[model samples]
Target chain A: MDFRINDEQRQMRETAQEFFEDREVLERARERIDGEDVVDDLWDDLSEMDYPALTVPLEHGGLGDDVLYLSLLLEEAGRVALPAPLPETLAFGAFVLDELGSDAQKEQFLPAIADGDQRLSFALYESGQESLPRDIQLAATPTDDGYRLDGTKTLVPFGEQVDTIVVAARTGSGTGMDGVSLFLVDAERVDSEPQDTLDRTRPAAKLHFDDFEIGENALLGTEGEAGPTLQKAMDRYTVATCAMTVGAASRAVEMSSDYGSQREQFDKPIGQFQAVKHRIADMWMATQAARSLTYYAAWALENDEPDAARAVSEAKLFCSEQLTQVFADDIHNHGGMGFTSEHDGHIYFKQAKAWETFLGTPTEHLDRIADSHEL
Target chain B: MDFEYTEDQERFRQELREWLRENLPDGWQAGERPGTDDPEENVEFLLDWQRTLNDGGWAGLHWPEEYGGADASLLEQVIYNQETARVDAPARINAVGIDFVGPTLMELGTDEQKERFLPKIISGEELWCQGYSEPDAGSDLASLSLSAERNGDEFLLNGQKVWTSYAHVADWCFLLTRTDDSGPKHHGITVFLVDMDQEGIQTEPIHQITDETDFNEVFFDDAVAREEHIVGEIDEGWEVAMTLSAFEHSMSDVFSIEQRWRSLVEFCQEHERDGTPLAEHTHVRRELARLHTRIQAGKLTHYRNVSKQMETGVPGPEGSMDKVFNNQTEKKLENFARRLLGANNALWTDGPDDGQWVTDLLMPYGKMIAGGTKDVQRNIIAERVLGLPKDD
Candidate 1:
């Protein structure tokens, strides 16, 4: 069994690397963190590169069902800490639409998403609740002509800027993975309040759906049957986050390695010391493990392997835990400069922490894995 | 990227599995094979098992066909390792011979040496052990003081080698000898293929923490290593030794780790505390799940190593990463098994699972020391992979 990426995937990854590198995305990310509106153009540039369409099906005016390919692009985006909702747009938005969207819904959204004419965001988690089907408290009451959504979706990626928000709300009377439904809502009709997220590069918002009425055509999939579909979508999003964590952790290792080689205290590079050297080595090992698990999870999900859910949870758990440690080690290696907001090291550190808490924390994923295995 | 084996590889795995199923001695069981308690019987049984594997064309599966192997691809070798572990097949007795010495010979041995040694090594006819570490040169192997002075047609070997595994039963040794002191510590050393069944060589078994005698302290006095037995040049043994060590580090142990993890899971599933299975406890489930994820990640890391080796045609520093990861993960897993077993972890022969968890827990310490210490592996990754400045 070959583990190396194929030539096409290699080419796509290389192209993404060149694009992200040439765009000076990291510098722009720092600027955005400093309150400059420098990310919109970069997002548009990514759209021009057709990254949002990378995971859509061929029949939907996009590449095809390739989560692995989309993950590669997300990894590149994560490497530079690109300030955008690329994961939300592609891994969650386009992916869910392709998987469970009706023909009318696909026709209305997929092509525009592929054409980079429309941006999408997902609203899954609610305040003080986990991202589980039964945990969703958002109510989608049946109306005469449609349903009215009347709850808040916290931590919605790109919640304020995206054109459409896919919301997971309770539609039936059942609980615990039953009665959950997906709806496509116009972003303008919802009240969005951007939160002061730790990862400014990928901002989040709290979307308030106060009796937000939508027509029956707005239903993403069959009502009360969206549990598995939403779970799969969340799994895709989790794997995307993992891939990004690999990239960001890798970049952190590189940055720390460079800093260790150049920064000296005892008339030599500090890296010559076993303390620093071994720490970096461990960080490197952790990053490599994260990459391997992320890629395997992505492949498992794409192929619909029997263990896909468990693999996804495993990847999320390992990557989230390891990325945080890698970044902490990195920051420790950089000394004082690593702690400053001005230095690029803190960017990765913050992003690692943010990603660790995103989708699911390490403990949450561990529970998911345990439950999946019926332990 | 693909994780699925091709049909041919699957067939290779199935063939080996079928061979093992039909060939293993009657009443064979994992961890309770022919000789579980007696070292001598265990060695004999392992030798017989290796011969059986050789007869089945599975020994040294990755070796070239010219050398009596199947000429299996790297993936096939991985499959061999995994399937063997899955069935809990007896480990090959001549590991040093097949995994290290033969490969090193293929790379650096003369045609005569290959013709003479390769077949016996693969067949387990002449068991081999590596003689590299010395009393004072464990991590700093290049500083070993094992001297081998050249004479008329042979080298007179006089040195003490420590931590030599299976030396008591080995018929031959691939020795690292310091032939000169004129240059740096890493220079003027030589590798010699020395016969161990001679008066000049003696082995004293070292009882380990596991209460096993798998390790030994070997002393040599005027041991005869002919000039033709030298691998590569006389003073260039460092490169040859590094090659063997790379092979050692690159050997996949993830299958065994996975095996132990499965055993632990079974233990948790069957045993209970206060009317509930251990697996039902949230703490136990979390820990098992965590270890399970780490094991899967370790397996993937090994695949990445295999892929890298396939591309480069040689094991690189990435192998050290696998070694370090597996060593740590395996140690943690075994320790967790003990913790899960509680006081029952102390019982041997009569305890739960016949005290396998206890032995498994004590086993990883040697692994952490063998091939290379985990710290030395980190140093390799730091220096070779990360290009960090070496400590003065």
Candidate 2:
């Protein structure tokens, strides 16, 4: 078995990493820490590079790379703390549409997304979820033409001002998971107010769907059967976010190592002190572990491994917990500058904390794993 | 990028699996290997098992073919390790001879040394221990005072080595001796192949916290090592010693870690707290999940190390990463299990499966110390891997 990435993946990683580095995505991220503002140039550059089409099938006017490829791009974005819903609009959104969308839906949407004319947002959370497959309180009552959606989806990332919104809602009757359906709605049909999220670098919103009407074509996949499809979509999202978190943590580790080598209080570099050196070493170790698990999870999901969902949850739990610690220790390594508002360290720190809570916390994923693996 | 083994490797894995199925001594299960309670019986059982492996041409698979090995490719060696660890086959009692002494001999030993020593190592007729660490040279190994003076056709060896695993049972030792005191400490050392049966050699078993005496303090009072037994040139022992230690650092039995973790998960599922399965508890679930994730990551890291080794033709600092991370994870897992067991943790030999958890819990401290201390590993990462400034 080989753990090394193939030449194609290596090229993809280099391209993505170089784009972020040359664009100074870190500075751009720093400029919009207080709010979510998509830098037009950065988005255009990504679009020009066909990043949004990363998950689309080659037959459908896009790059045909799998979840592993998308994960690399997201990780690069995460390393620079790029304040965008690339994972939402590109990785997760494109995946759901490609797998579950009809020909009409794909025809109507996929090209604009590929060309950067449209951005897709996902509305999956209703209120706050203590567990996954949470009771979908959002109701999608069938109408003569299509369906009318009512209820709110909290934590709808990039919820405001998106071209299309794919939402998870209960259609027919039963409680959990069953009768759950995914619908693509025009962004203008719903009301979205930006929420003061923990990481303003990537803003989230509370979406209010009050009699939001959608056409018959909006229904993604089979109505009640959308549960498994949605679960798969969420798994992809979890792995993508985990890959990003891994990137962010490694960046934190890199910055901390640099700081440790340069910063000194005594006769020697502070890195020479065991306490400082070991703590940074610990962060580095955790970051490597997170990266390995994330890559494995991506591989498993792409290859349809038997334990795919378990692997996804494992990556989510590991990367979330590890990135949080790495970011925290990174701040400690930076001393006073890390505590200040101006330093890029806090941006990574906040993004890490945000990502930890973003799909699910480590504790939540742990519970999910317990159920899945029957631990 | 592929995680699955090649077809040939898979076939080899199946072959080994079938061989193990037919040949493994009865009552052996993954994660249920016997300890050092009955050293002689354990030795006998292990030697017999090693002979079986040798008979099957599976012994020392990584060694060159001329030295009584299969001369398997790196992938085959990895698959062999993975499969053997999966079956919990009795660990080869001659592991020190095979993994450490034999490899060093292949690199630096005279042709006669290889012919004399390599066959017995694979045949399980001889066992070896490493004699690098002294009582005062635990982390600062170069400061070791174990001295040997050159004599005609021999070296008169004298001094002490501590924490030498299997020394009490080993038939020979790859020893580090300070041959000259005039120059730099690291410059004056030599490595010798010392016969354990010789006079003027004494071994005092050191009972570890596990209540086992696999480790010992070996004293050499004018012990004789023939000139032909010296590995590499004299005054270059430091480099020779580093070779074996590097192997030890990278070669963790990670599949066994996976097996133990699976058993722990089963334990968490079978036992309950507050009328719910212990795994159902959020805190317990979190701990178990953490353990599971690290084990998975450690397993993959081993693969990454192997991949890096294949590319570089030598193991890199990445092995130290595996060594540090795996040891730390084991320590955390053991501590977590101990707490989860609570009062039951004290039931050594009275608990489940004859107190295996108790032993497993106490066993990782040695791992942290062996190869090199965790601090030394961190130093290696800092200095060698990360290119950080070294201490004055």
For model 1 chain A, where is the 10-residue window of minimal lDDT? A128-137
lDDT of 2 by residue, B1-392 (tens): 77988889889999999989988877685435654568777777887888998999888878878777887877788787778777667777787888888988988889999889988999988888989899888889999889898778888998999999888888989999999889988899999898999888999999889887788999999999988888999899889987765542236657777777777788878898778988777788777777887888888878877877777677777777888888878888888888877688778888776777777888888888888888988888877877677877
Model 1 interface RMSD, in angstroms?
0.9
Fnat of candidate 1: 0.84
The lDDT per prediction is 0.86, 0.81
lDDT by residue for model 2 (A135-164), tens: 676899999999899998888877874778
Candidate 1 accuracy as TM-score: 0.97
Q: What's the residue-level lDDT of A155 in candidate 1?
A: 84
Show model 1 residue runs off by greater than 4 Å.
Answer: B245-250
lDDT by residue (A46-128, candidate 1, tens digit) is 87788877887888898775888788877887888888777888888887888788888999899988888778898888874
